[model samples]
Target chain A: MTTRAKQFISADQLLEHWQGHRNLTRRVIEVFPDKELFEFSVQGMRPFSTMVVELISIAGPALKGIVEQQITEFSEEVFQPKTKEEILARWDAETEVINHYFNQISEEKFQETFNLFGQYEFPVYQNILYFIDNEIHHRAQAYTYLRSLGIVPPFFWERF
Target chain B: MTTRAKQFISADQLLEHWQGHRNLTRRVIEVFPDKELFEFSVQGMRPFSTMVVELISIAGPALKGIVEQQITEFSEEVFQPKTKEEILARWDAETEVINHYFNQISEEKFQETFNLFGQYEFPVYQNILYFIDNEIHHRAQAYTYLRSLGIVPPFFWERF
Candidate 1:
């Protein structure tokens, strides 16, 4: 007789986890002093604003693309918001879109492979996790920038 | 008539995504110069070694605890590996354990909430994502430390 293994988490929990990261990232954006968000970099890496643009371009649209099965070309257009409030608005807007598109995905479709942004083909869940991973990666950079500027970032665990 | 949404990934795909982050993090650990891993810090935050210990302590045992329905107390024991090689070994060991225990999870259990490590009561999947999130957070710190030390971290997209 063979016993079955239990699942680790549900789709809803995955969405919650993704949102938690997004929430923390939004807070990180809020804490950045205006000039530093666009000016600070370590060893000539891109500024935090550019990183935010990359994130903004990817999160909502990528999920929508996956949901729609649309193989869209990767565009290089980065939204240049003039202020922190503008960035936050864009971020919040994208967050809503992410929720809307994410719920459109049912459990079984997660196993199907899709070419994300007309680029790499992987399981849809992998693509979504990439969104979360990329966000955390950039947020870490922002955190370092904050510490360098003598400002403390929000504690890592405060994801609510 | 109701329209149904498609799921874009499976539990297996989510595990793959989590493993990719782990793989990249392992590469980050390997690339660090011996002394810098433990000695470097920004604004007096904990060193990268301590961060790795936090990751090691949380991942394998956390999954095991979740799978076995055991609520273990969080331990503050940071492994003081004398060498980078030692750190890599511990990391590899934990990685193997993660794979072994992760496979033990079934799809249904993901929807059930578990108090991970006797704290942070959430669905098991959220807890696992927390593992990935925490890793990315610290790895980014290590990236900053590497840049500050005039070393380059592995490319963020090279998680394979």
Candidate 2:
């Protein structure tokens, strides 16, 4: 027998929570020196810029797919920016895209399974959590890079 | 006016999600060579063992505080295990402790704000999320360490 799903958080709270993380990550991008943002990585991990691009590619695109009920192929090759300015511009633009699509999801839709990128078959909410989780995963790498550079990264708890 | 808070996920789901990350982290610990587990560092970051201790210090202790409704000072000095087996033993023991206290928390308790460690003041749910979030944060660092050592980390998605 299947158990009824209980809501753990509100959609508004989830959006705000995800956005708080985005804001913190944006601050991370801002703190990086222009050259280092694209070049600095410890332990053979991709540079912070590359990691940021992976995040940029996921949330807005995946949400759009979820809202539209379509499974589209995931790709990070959509943008090839030579500068941090270009990346930040896309980040701000994607924020709006995320907001637009996130509100379209009804609370009930969160429990429906969607095969994200034709691979990860999980509930809508779990997929959304994946997006946020993946960001935190990469941002931690940036934190190490920052500490190595002797630059203090933004506080992890100050998510607003 | 205070708005009604909606539930987005169940406490069981939250515990499962957190444990998934912990399982992946445990794999990382298991793959490490004994000496390197304690000494390896890239970019001046602390060794993975130290980070694991920090995580161990939080989840069980913090959850116990929340369940008991007591605010205690946060400290990582409680455990000073000198071996990987010691750390793993403590990890397994703490898992039970986490499950014990986690079930004691009522749904309404998730909405109440508590001063975590006499430091972080947030709703019970947010505090719990922080515990999970903090684990992923440190575990990501361990992933990098593993990669640098030519040991591939456990698949991040394979939480179970």
Candidate 3:
């Protein structure tokens, strides 16, 4: 049933949308105090810095794998950035890689399915969406952590 | 510089990606206790139910406006659903409307710019992304509310 729906967004727009969310998530990361980003968590969830590492590992590398059609094993070298600035720098580098790899994805490739990171067989578009959805999910956790620390996150509407 | 990037996803994939997020958000809403859904807030933000209403107001109607080329004024008559069941019903109805209007959008229509809800002029694709992004933003707030109340949110990957 879901297969019959028509395409509504172009590949460029999808990139834009993904980038907008990334931008906002970056801002959310910025709002975190240095210690809390690496050390804080509610219940048993990982800290915001840990979550950022997961995102950093997925986004740029996943796009490269998808575009290159190389279904490599998912092995994230855990990045433990002690400072928020270091984390932000890693985030920026990943952002650049995402942009570079994303541009290599032609419109036709979006329809082709690939086993992303040697798992999760879905079309390229869905894979990209997973990258986005995953970021939103973790960032939500970070938002909770921020609020708990009596910090206000950057406004959601400011994506640029 | 960003404008020259090629599109990566078709319209249908975008819709699927969006619906997945919406599905997860619905589950998030369901997880909320009845009174707390409407009453709870962290750092003076509006309750989750209120955020849901704002979403309900925008999505279906925005799609209708975009497809029909009717740039109507944005006037959200606040819906105060008394029960979780009522909220779910409204959500389901809006989901249906979103499907219906989303199908009305043609490939060409997505490229044309429309002043969404009489504000924020962008192409239809960006506007649709806005809807998804806004929902994610609010749902994150809801997640924080849920965790703070000792309720675990639905797993982020289980969007299907």
> Where is model 1 chain B poorest over a 10-residue stretch in terms of lDDT?
B1-10
Q: For model 1, what TM-score does chain A reach?
A: 0.94
lDDT of each: 0.82, 0.86, 0.81
For residues B1-160, could you state the per-residue lDDT of candidate 2 as single tens digits? Answer: 3444444567787788878888888988998999999999876678999999999999999999999999999999889889999999999999999999998998778878999999989998888888888888888877777777888777778888
Task: Give the runs in model 2 whose Cα sits over 4 Å from its true position.
Answer: A1-6, B1-6
Q: Residue A22 in model 3: shift from native, Å?
A: 2.4
Query: Order of candidates by DockQ, top first?
Result: 2, 3, 1
Best-to-worst TM-score order = 2, 3, 1
User: What's the count of clashing pairs in each model shown?
Assistant: 14, 9, 11
Question: Candidate 3 - CAPRI tier?
Answer: acceptable
Task: DockQ for candidate 2, please give it.
Answer: 0.57
Q: Pick the candidate with the highest DockQ.
A: 2
Mind giving the per-residue lDDT tens digits that candidate 1 earns over B1-160?
Answer: 3332233345666677778888999999988888888888888588888889889889998989989999998875757677888888998898789889988886656657899878789777667777888899889888988888888889988978
Among all windows of 10 consecutive residues in model 3 chain A, the one with the lowest summed lDDT is A1-10
lDDT score of model 1?
A: 0.82
For candidate 2 chain B, the 10 contiguous residues with the lowest summed lDDT are: B1-10
